[model samples]
Target chain A: MNGAEKIRVENLTKFFINGKTAVSALENVNLTVNDGEFLCVVGPSGCGKTTMLRILAGLEKPTSGRVHINAKAAGVPSTAVVFQGDSIFPWMRVVENVEYGLKLRGVPLKERRAVAMEHLKKMGLERFAYLYPYQLSGGMKQRVNVARAFACDPEILLMDEPFGALDEQNRLLLQQELLRIWEENCKTTVFITHSIDEALLLGDKILVMTAQPGKVKALLDVKIPRPRDIILIKSSPVFIELYKEIWDLLKEEVLKARNIK
Target chain B: MNTTEERLSQNRASLGKEFWLKTFSFLSPLFLLFLWEALAALKLVDVRLFSSPSRIFKTLIPLVLSGELIYHTLISTMRIALGFLAGAIPGVALGLSMGLFPSVRALLMPLVAVTFPIPKLAIMPLILIVFGLGESSKIFTIAIGVFYLVLINTMAGVLNIDPIYIDVAKSFKASRIQFYTTVAFPGALPMIFAGLKLGMGTALLLIVAAELSAAKAGVGWMIWRAYDMFDIERMFCSLIVLAFLGFVFSYLLDFLEKIVIPWKKR
Candidate 1:
């Protein structure tokens, strides 16, 4: 772990519905996200990947063990979340939504609007600053979500399938845009995705989790060089090997979940 | 982009229709006024019983200028405003608490369901006996009528809130107060406004009913006085004031809703 560990999860366990019909969501899951690392969590459905992300975000309490931020306590640090559903406040305009956390922290209008406009410009949404969430497309809304999270200048960003709802073309475009933003910001990020392709595209280190009682089955470090392009990365031999390994790990869980003969 | 452009054009046409609809809405009332004047001019009906618009306006101008209209309207407005606040605040608070907590809901739901059907104004005679035939009795009657409607709306609003929003707020680690103020309160605004608008109308209607029963100074009092003396022209003037007053109060509430909830804008 050395000096790289930004977040250290030590034997984190979470169980749902109490002891009555206790189903363990995460069992003694241990992981570390290094500083400036874009980590992706990929796993099958019902694998408790979201549960893990929620625990890290301090949205859910772990039944046992601990989650630490830089070896400090972990209970909702100045971390921002980009939920799958955009989570942009419907009532606020694009700029207002982007400035919400800043406003909550008592940033004045002149300063917050400037900061919000800066972020919106980066997200390519500067034109629609006055538009409401409902007025924007699925792709544009996600851009606002990204811009909002980053505008807070949070210690870490936790995104839970932010592009999962978009069409393939929008999703791909957004994935590239996210990579560009992540490269520029270089904030410690924990992105959750079900797609192996997405995990490969964004993550420096991918934590492949298993189903039922979810546990980090493997941590596959992507060997691809920086400034990676999606098209080129897909053609690379390293991408294929890592993708295959993660696919096999996921295949077992898929079969087990379906009770396949 | 193509889909949105199509939708934008469709919405533009609908907006054009909305403008025409608004124009027609204003014009329909004027058309009705013209019809009424025409009937009276042609001597189609007893002009004394149902006075013409011009006759009513002529009578209203003097009453309004002499400060009688302002005095009566002010008195009625003040009473209704006081009663509305007294009833609505507590009613919404109680309704919200009941709607949010099941234990409270279980205990009070039966009580509310039972008593809701009973006419609130029917207790006016009882209220008159208890509070006396003064401003207290009239205000109490108005408050009670408003309370029933406001309380029900408050409860329904809270009940009908999408649970997804609560879950979203919770998942964001929002504090209890933050959750209530940011999520629940705003979430319930549309419905609460619905109730408030209804309650305002109810309170205004009940004020007239209360004053008609017994009062010395109010629009309703003027109404009752005019009816008793068979002062047709003055009575028509009073009725016009009542209609205008109702319109103004409701329009004020609508204006407030627009400012507070600009999100509801299409």
Candidate 2:
């Protein structure tokens, strides 16, 4: 592990126990995420990438092995996750949703509201700060979710296919929006997605995982320059090459997952 | 231009039809009332059995002016309010705990299932024996009825909350109090309100049953008294008041639901 490592996973494994059956979700997954790194993990469905993210977020416990975060000397490092579905509280307004983390931490109401509003503005959602989550479109709700993760100002962000439910237009729009916010904040992030193009577009390094009982297949460095445009980045030669490379690795896993000829 | 004009006329005709349909819907009850009045005036039916609407109103007006109607209405309302609070508060608390804690659920669920199906009125004799044929018995009967309805509904509400919301709360590192107050409670609120509405209706039903069995006061007792005396008009008056009470209680709950859960509006 490098001195700059923010997160280190050592042979992490998880098995879901149901009645008399134990299903392996992940197997011997070892990885390190450097400080302020944007690491995207791409894989076929049932690859346990979400399970890995959940473990990192402390929402789930690995059946074996361990994950260590390089916490500051003061306390444990704070981490926030953006889940795949609409995880925003329907009862809370957009601003309240964004400020949820700070509120839970016992930050005073006024200060938290200010921080929430600031993040909302960054997402260009200042106008919708008072609106309820139900009033917003799916894309807007996801924006609120992203803004909330950013507002918490955690040491790391774990996003599990946050925009996976959106349309192609919304998916691209949010990808760009996420990049803009990430560029500004640059927190250590582990984003899990099934989209190879998305993995290349956002990740500093893309970790591809194998089919069921997921293990790291490859970690390819994205070498794409910063201040990337979502539309223009796709046309670049290196971007196509990276996409093809990841796709080539991912196709076998997809077929293997589906048991297709 | 001609087609546009034709479409406008068609829209206007449909609008006119809709207006009359709504107006007719409103007038339907009046039509029934007038028919009853006509039948009584023409001596086409037995006046003692099917009292005219005017006669019922006349009896009601006197009862109101003499404060008899108001007194009985207040008594019934007070019993319901007290009994509903007694039942609903504990029911919701227990239900929430039952939904959240496995041990509590294990302890209470079987009891709830066994007791919920038995009509509350069936246990009136037991309640009467325990509390005597007094105010306590009447109130207790209503409370028990409301309790089961609210408890089951509340438990279902809590259980029905999407697990994802709980996961989100956990990920955010919400404390126990915050988890319940901010996530679990609010997530279960719509269902809780649903439970409360059902419980309120049950409270209304059970109150009348309890009152009819033993009470000297209340609209239900008045109806029974009028029946014994063969004062059909007075009985109709009491029935009208009971209907009004049910309407007001349901309307109050609907109004409270709107205020408490503004997000449910649209």
Candidate 3:
């Protein structure tokens, strides 16, 4: 059933023009995100992970090639994004920020409020619903970003390092919460992260991307069983072997990303 | 991430310091007034030319009771209201459109750049000739003065809004009107308020300049008449009233800003 393709990126290439020179960000990238599958992308910094997500979100047009998003659920919007930092409107209260997509969709106030409140509750932020984004901690603010994505209930959830700026503890905590929330009802999610552990913990398949002039280097499925966790997975041999294999694949790329001899 | 409760505690921690700050601000003006009175009482200064604070107040009560001051103040206030509204409405509208649409900005920017620095006061004679030195002329002058200030700030506010917010708006597929109304308007509000405050100040300034030259009835005209007759006390009294008006207008705008953008921390 998961064989059905949700998104297909064929020969995707993106170039940014800088002072009469075209700098390639993504070079002939091609990938597919299966329906209701959680695909995490791990890459070196400036690898055009964000650019790819933006293209997938339909916020940017591909310089070349094609991106096909099968919006199977008609009348339902296709994509919503969780940006890296401070994406929620500072002027809006927590609930308002969460309900923003619905508000744009012209959903009635009471109905959207109920949906936003429910998502906020899932993030343990129901108590902070009336507060402004300025009043939320970095960790809590990222949670608000997650809650908004969930509340929007788009067919595709595109996250660009939503927890990238958070401290270690908050990162693990939110990852656990995210896994729990997602496990309740699985949806097609594309999450970009810098951490291999994070990619393994959340994703069914991991796509490893190369350095600048980014291209798909490797794609591997996580064989580790579900109900896995940040700490619990550490003890599992399958998790350790998968972790070592990925680290080996990623270490060379990480060095190559820095142009290390 | 300062919550309301945390903010309250922080305020309490600095409560004594805040009190002293307010007290000092309040007392500094009174101290100056007292010193001026002392200089006048001792004949250390020319009372006839300078006029003591007491003499200014003495003249103020009669001006108020005789309805002369009230009538003039009302006229000036009315002109300010009319002109400020005229400028602010279109200024904000155009400013938002310009910031959101590059084409509108490109077309209007050259015109604004050329005309903005010519000095509205320099054009006052032309305005008077065109509008015939009536209320229309005074109101028109104030409007032009206010229009430029509000337009620039409001445009800057929209322009300064983080690009991320705009991208978020697009990802969600926000409608064109929604993009402007919900995203642009609220996002640019802080800058818009800055424009409004500056515009209000300009309105106050231009009202006086316009009324002094043209109007028969405003506080500025009253000051002009007092200056002509060498009634220094009446002039002092009118000046004090004008200062008071300025203070009131600034506080009113601050209050409105707080109400509109409550999410912003002080």
lDDT of each: 0.84, 0.90, 0.90
Alpha-carbon runs more than 4 Å astray in model 2: A1-3, A73-77, B1-14
In order, the TM-score of chain B in each prediction is 0.86, 0.94, 0.91
Every model: iRMSD: 2.7, 1.4, 0.7
Candidate 1 lDDT by residue in tens digits, B241-260: 78898899899999999898
| Candidate 1 clashes between residue pairs 3 or more apart in a chain or in different chains | none
Cα-based lDDT at residue B133, candidate 1: 79
For each model, chain A TM-score?
A: 0.94, 0.96, 0.97
Which regions of candidate 3 are displaced past 4 Å? Answer: B1-23
Q: For model 1, how does the per-residue alpha-carbon lDDT over A1-261 read when each residue is reduced to its tens digit?
A: 234779889999998986579887899899988888889998878889888888887878889999987634333335778887857777778998788777666668999899999999988899999987878888998899889888878778999999999999999888888888788858889999999999999998999888768888899898788777877899899999999999999898877867732
lDDT of 2 by residue, B1-266 (tens): 56988999999999999999999999999999999899999999888888898888888888999999999999999999999998999989998999888899999888888888998889999999999988999889988988887888788888888888988899988888888899878888888888888888898888778988878999888888998899998889888888898899999989998888877744
Could you give the candidate ranking by DockQ, starting with the highest? Answer: 3, 2, 1
RMSD of each: 5.1, 2.1, 3.7
Tens digits of per-residue lDDT for model 3, B166-216: 998998899999888878999999999999999988888888789888568
How high is each candidate's TM-score? 0.79, 0.96, 0.95
Give the least accurate 10-residue stretch of model 2 chain B, judged by summed lDDT. Answer: B257-266
All models, DockQ values? 0.26, 0.69, 0.83
